[model samples]
Target chain A: MEFLLLTEKCIWFGLGAAGFAVLFNVPPKTLIYIAFMGAMGGFLKAILMHFDETNVIISTLCGATLIGFLSIYFAHKTHCPPPVLAIPACIPMIPGKFAYKMMIGLVNLSGNIDHDTYTQIMSETVNNGLKVVFILMSIAGGVGIPLLITRKESSKGMRLRKRS
Target chain B: MIAPSPKNKEIKDLGNVLLNVGAMLLSSGASTGRTRNTISRISDSFGYSSDLLISHRTIMLTISDKKNDYFFNNLKRSAPHGVNFKLLSGISRLSWQVVEEGLSVNQINVQLSRLAALKHYPRWFTLLFVGLAGVSFCRLSDGDALDMVTVFTATVCGLFIRQEVHKMKFNPYICIFCGAFTASLIAGGGLKYGMGFIHEQALATSVLFLIPGVPLINSFSDMIDGNLNNAIVRGLNGFIISFAIGMGLLTSMLIYRF
Candidate 1:
């Protein structure tokens, strides 16, 4: 059951990414490439969290960086912009739960300014809200670093090689 | 007005085509750096020196044939935001072909029109996949099987409404706001009626499809590439979409609470 759960989430993540690829209108040829990237990133994050050794930010950074590296390779092979692959692949890491909780907490706090229950909710809200921002920033930065180094040069070189 | 020379007329026409292509790229959510480079490369292939000034909403392009002393300038606004990687790739390929293959202006125009004419996936197909994606997100977030099924159904219904609203030409914010509201309402209602195992996960993942992943990433890319204006603009746009989504989700919760 444990092993099955591990693989199951990854498969679902990949399928989810394929759905996003279609939504984004990526060419069919590269859909599998993107799904693989998404699966790897999503799986790696889940594994790290399972270990409980690192927090959400670290795990997300690792996963997003993996997506970035693979995006570079796949973008080259497929001749599409790296963003086209990286964006959808990274969507699975967006921390939707935190964002939703933050909003709910805010609504409760607004309705009851001084209640003890509201105070606890407010603290949880702040924690979750901060996690959402930090995790998102980590993912963006993790992917952006690789893209900055390779994306412009590889495309330029490809153009030059074609010209020659 | 002085009668324009033939070379001036030719440059003007090419300028217009370049403007159209640039606007299409920007509107399609191409990063500012990519849009600028592609436009410049395309103009270079046509033997014109060009400068492109891109912001979040507008592109200002000037094409000059310095040897013949011809200059043409045009400003165009970006179209609505949508992501079509095939279109981006097609335009990228077209730019390279123009540069290396020495395609003529008329041939480039033909290819551009063909690429532009490409359509997104069929509406039903998109709706189905978006629903599946929502279900997948629910699972990834550790939602139980029941929650996944609930999210899947809600997402499909919500996205269908979004597609229809878009067809009717509503503002994008309004469309997303309504879509999120509908999706969350379904999920929230389902949980209220004891349809899902996890209420939070169902409500959370149902709106995953509306997350604006591309723009959020592109804003970071734009900032790193030193296109601050475009970066700020894209960032604000992403933030607004997020606000719309939050508003939509809250609206459903509020109704559910009552």
Candidate 2:
């Protein structure tokens, strides 16, 4: 069951990413490559997180950095920009449940409530909201690594390279 | 009447080309740095120095010729931001062509039109696959077979509503609000009624396709690149959209008490 869960994580995340790519109108040929990258990143995160010792933020950062670097190679093969491939593939890593919980806490806290209840709700909201923020930052920070190093599009220097 | 000199006309033309490219890139999802770089590359290739002021929805460009001592300024209001990777990639390539070929302004304009006219993947394809994405998201959250069906149903309905509302020229926020409301209505109902063991997971992931993931990442990337103003504007935009989606979900939850 544990192994199955890990493997399915990869497949489902890949499908999710491919769906996202379609929504963004990525060219048809690139979808497979984007799915492959998404799967690899999702699997890496799943494995790291399953160990139960590593922090979620660290695991997410590693997954996203892997996606970021992979995007360069995949983007080269697909003939698209790196972000075009990387961003959508990273979407599955978003903190959806945390965001949902924070919103709910906010809504409940706004109504008339006792002091203890208010404190409890506030704590929950802060915890969930902070998680969402850090996870988002990690995703951005991790994926940004490749983008920073690449500087210019891979296609930019292809002609110059051939000439030289 | 003295005719304007050819050099003067050329500088004006260059300014127009720069505005068009900047507007297209900014609106079509290029980051601030890329848009600035592409504009500078094109202008430099044309022997003009360029400077740009890029805001949330407008680009102000200045072009100057050093020896001729000519400076021209142009401003254009960019279209609303949307995720279209094809346009982003297309314009990047076009920028390279401008530099490599020394293409005339008219030729670049022709190429821009061609790229703009390029068709997206079929609408039904996006709609169906987006729902599949929702299903995949549901599964990732540990949803079961029954929950997958529930999410698929909710997502297709939600996305269809969004597209329909968007096509009618409704504000994009309103479109997202409506989509979120529809998806959560169905998923919330499933959660309330216990449609499956994983129905809660379905409910959570159902409206997630509406999250502005691109804008969020773009904002972070912009901040890292030191475009602080653009970053703040984009970050705020992402937050507001998330809040709107949350409000829609809240409304559903209130109705269903889930």
* Best model per DockQ: 1
Clashing pairs in 2: none
In model 1, state the lDDT of residue B71. Answer: 92
**Alpha-carbon runs more than 4 Å astray in model 2:** A113-119, A152-163, B195-198
Q: What is the TM-score of chain B in candidate 2?
A: 0.96
> Candidate 1: misplaced stretches above 4 Å?
B1-3, B195-198
TM-score of each: 0.95, 0.94
lDDT of 2 by residue, B34-73 (tens): 8888899899889898888999889998889987567898
- The residue-level lDDT of candidate 2 at A72 comes to 88
Please provide, for model 1 over A1-164, each residue's C-alpha lDDT reduced to its tens digit, 9 standing for 90 to 100: 87778798899878888899899998889889989999999899889988885498999999999999999999879878788888888887888888888887788778847677877887899999999999988888878889988977887788688767
Candidate 2 lDDT for residue A104:
80
What are the interface RMSDs of all the models? 1.2, 1.2
lDDT of 1 by residue, B1-258 (tens): 878898888898889888888888887778999898888888887788998888887889888886757899889987887888888888887887887778877887899889888888898898888899999989877788889889999999989888889899999999999899999999998888884455678988898889988888889988999999888888888899999999999898888883
